[model samples]
Target: MGEYKPPFTITNKILSYISSISEKIGRITAISNLETKPHLRRNNRIKSIHSSLKIEANSLTLGQVRDVINGKSVLGEQKEIQEVKNAYIAYEHLEEIDPYNIQHLKQFHGIMTRYLVEESGEFRSGEEGVFNGSQCIFMAPPARFVPQLMDELFSWMKESKDDVHPLILSSVFHYEFVFIHPFSDGNGRMARLWHTAILSKWKPIFEYIPIESQIEKFQDEYYRSISECHIAGESTIFIEFMLSQIDKILDDISVQINEKNEYLPEAVQKLLEVMEYDIPYTSNELMERLGLKAKEGFRRNYLHPAMEMKLIQMTIPDKPNSRNQRYLRC
Candidate 1:
């Protein structure tokens, strides 16, 4: 095989983000005791699949994604619904995946793109380009080079596992995988799922972090980072961005855990767990975090009750959904 040294210059900023992410990962590992509860684990896996597919423009809402995963019928385009199903199937087999195995990578792509693409598990025979509407943002290397390039990349990853930090390695792999654009379809989803696979191998807590949920929240930035990395011919920016997302997700989980431990009334406790005491969060963010699907029901039961209980306060007292609407704990 060729000598595979991925292109990326590590800087202090990258180091700083990696250090912060590592600390957060350590904290999460300690808090989780390396054991994620079954219900929470399932919820996170659903969120990961939903958010990743949503980033790819799947029309299914998180609620509908949950329904589909639960074996309930969801009203959406058949392809989108199938995307959710395929993602769940791939994630269910995460335990059996060898993250550094190239064959496993193709297997995952097959599972993730089953019935959704003509060339499901196979790398593209034709060339590929990433398009944003009429604009072509990225073009992959020639089709003939894919197998060799992917093999070299995986070989580099396997060799670098001990020398490089998992956070940096996973982020680098994610950026490079997208840059390669090996598959005819499902490359974006594969990049995401594979990065999570890499991280879960390093720390089991990552299997439950739902970093894809955070990525969906920052979708524009996510693409921008990739575009910038492609232009720069290095993965540094993308690595930093992914590590930041991971750190934020870890912070949110930590906040969720600590807030749940607080002594509060049953009605407002869930609200408090979702809210930040200092930083304001949008109602949608809070509701999504709490898994509340109905805005009216959420307001009447959770939001209004929390407000009435003097436990949470609105950023704009007069305007609920305008003029910078957000909520924070009292």
Candidate 2:
């Protein structure tokens, strides 16, 4: 109400999570230029967009979102598809955002909600509610209060940049932003995007981290954390909850990196170095991407070994020579 300072305590659980996440960050850093790995970076960004939209009840699969972003025709409702396209653009332009700038948050929200909401970048002039089907769970603060509320939140964030760990600060901002319900729609998406944006500013590697995917994986728990904190009058639960999610996501990333490093065939690893994964590639397409014209030598050294190692598999495994066949990383 007055000048808002988020109330929260860093308990032992939060400290442990911070410690674990830091160690995992060191491990994840070992993959030289992992933040620059095009495939990983693109895939993570797509995953973030897809999952954040999914949490908002957008009925599009991850592949469908990826396809939409790739400029392909996706058969879905016009509004849902537009949301995906908008989110993709918003994330791709994240470099233009400033984490502690109130205007930047409004600008990003405009990008996020574009055609999906009439209010877009503007704070709602009417009351809004968080709902479960027909039932409302929480009514937002009065619309008149939004601008000043947002100003204080951003001012606190800027002033606390040195005093707060980005992890803790971002999570606190995330919870508070959701509580403020600053926009007419897309608050959840903005919260998630800004959380990653805040962390990415802290360490560029976070640009490639799919923390939203983890939130989508455990969505019920995510809502529960917010609701509990709302009742408890502090964001400590949400802070610990977020730190726990980061710990889990970083752990998963470390495992994936080590698995590929230890087991993938050298040729297949090289192939992936050039390939954008989760989509299929035909033999000719694969060869062309690698700039190899001789089919047999290319197959023996790269394709066959990759298949033998199961790093990649044929799309039509039953008929390996199917004319319509393609290959995808496993």
Candidate 3:
């Protein structure tokens, strides 16, 4: 087995920051589970935003991340659009599988890389390069080291018994794996997805935490952290950067939860509870579930009130009159 080395002083500073962030993650988890209509909506929107950001960040082709959030066909051609749609579907399905399972990881890779590239889920069998413009900046381990690195990662994840914090492990693993750049493409996105998977496995609040938004907010910092780690021969700076972002995200959610606790109405609150896990409601669906005779009445009395408070966002932003319009608890 290969022995892992501890990072030095600069790396220790990063780990210390991560420790602080991990402490707050517990608070964020508590706030997420609390009963509050406004906070629930805020949390849900954050989750949606983060998921969307993940898709944009992970895509091989470049486009505005906003285009993805607005549901525009930024990928252009039919084949490219189909590939992006497939990736979204696969990401949604990630909730159903265990991230710790190596099989599931490979499956995610398969779905993520399908049609985008020839290798897809398979690991690189030869040399790889990281480049900026015309210059190559760094090269990963030799081809022979690829399988062993993956094996060690899987084994560490499975056998870790020290109550090592999942978020910490996730940050560390994300940096290390991306550094390895095991696959031919999609390494950055895969690392983020895998981090979420690991966190969700540890605490379900991670399912709602939109870490990607924070990443997108500081994309340059994110890249810099990774590069710094590469140059310094330590994972600590990257870990600290990730943890600090998570801390801020959780803090934001906590404030939103507190505000929701103060002002959300009872009917709207109950609706939020009902739709906590499953969302995307139509007028008819709301009428059926709430046992109301008139769809308009239900909207005026229940849905509109929630919408006014921003507890629900319209699915059809442009065409409110469309029969296909749906409401999701955002």
Candidate 4:
């Protein structure tokens, strides 16, 4: 492990993805209202937790994950439900964790695997492997080598932090982390979390980008990228795969933001225009703001459609007809 650089090449295609992703991140973060938009941030964070857990065969649906987070009783396995809970708690502390510190990573893992794994915070004391059905796809380094390998990897990351682009830096760390397979049960989840954490440190908007959703959509390609890279003895392929995913996720967010009005009903679009993302408006208040005198028409053509499309969510979902109910743009 002497002077180890964790073997990865940056290609021109990777450069293109980085440029595009960086620009999108900058544009998104530059929006003044983003910091105050809880709905937007919450939606993305829930998707990330749900999708990452789903990739680990957690068997909980995205809606169920949201329900669990909201303290609603959901019918699911205890382990999967606990995974969602754990992930939510861990993600809430993203701003506090130091990505370059190995102890912080292990501490985060402890939080992530609490009540689930036998050795929550500790690296595997035995051999580990990546399995696909009954076949073994990759064998991790021996347990004795885990500490030194991880120490070297983290040292490299800290030393190179100022010199490398985070898109590449995080991607390399992800590939190397998986190859190390340090944890007994939560290796994949940790890899995804740390990858997001690293990017978020670079640009806070990344904490809300739902990169896990993109990874879950291309789970096969993710594993394929890892296997190909392992065979080639470098992370170049996986880095490219992840950069492409980030580029695509940015494009997806742009579509939902810019082109949603194209498919929305005219009434819904008009209603949304009258509302601010960070403000909650009661139906009567919204109607007054819209200069609509008829409650029935507004509810039928505007409110109902917006609610159906989830363009707006009721502040009191359980008691939608509550007098105190308010609607906020989602």
* Candidate closest to the true structure, highest lDDT: 4
Per residue, candidate 1 scores C-alpha lDDT tens digits across 1-330 of 547788888889888887887887676666554242454566678889989998888888877888888799888899999999999999988878889999899988999999889999998999998754456678889999998889889989989999998888998899888888999999989998999989889877777779999999998888888889888989988988887888788888775554344455564766764553354778788889888889898888888888886778888998876857988776
TM-score of 3: 0.70
After superposing candidate 4 on the true structure, give the runs of residues whose Cα lies further than 4 Å from its correct spot. Answer: 133-135, 258-294, 297-301, 304-330
- Model 2, 117-225: lDDT tens digits are 8898989888887654455657889999988888888888988889898999999999999988989899999999999999989887888789999999998888888
TM-score of each: 0.79, 0.94, 0.70, 0.83
* Worst window of 10 by summed lDDT in candidate 2: 255-264
Residues 251-324 of candidate 4: C-alpha lDDT, one tens digit per residue: 77765444456577778867876775546789999999789999999999999989998889999999988999
Estimate the lDDT of model 2. Answer: 0.86
Model 2 regions more than 4 Å off:
1-3, 132-135
**Residue ranges of candidate 1 with Cα displaced over 4 Å:** 33-36, 259-330
Better of 3 and 4 by TM-score: 4
By lDDT rank, best first, the candidates go 4, 2, 1, 3
Q: Write down the lDDT that model 4 would get.
A: 0.88
Pairwise TM-score winner, candidates 1 and 4: 4
Q: Model 2 compared with the native: what TM-score? A: 0.94
With candidate 2 superimposed using the best TM-score fit, by how many Å does residue 115's alpha carbon deviate from the native?
2.1
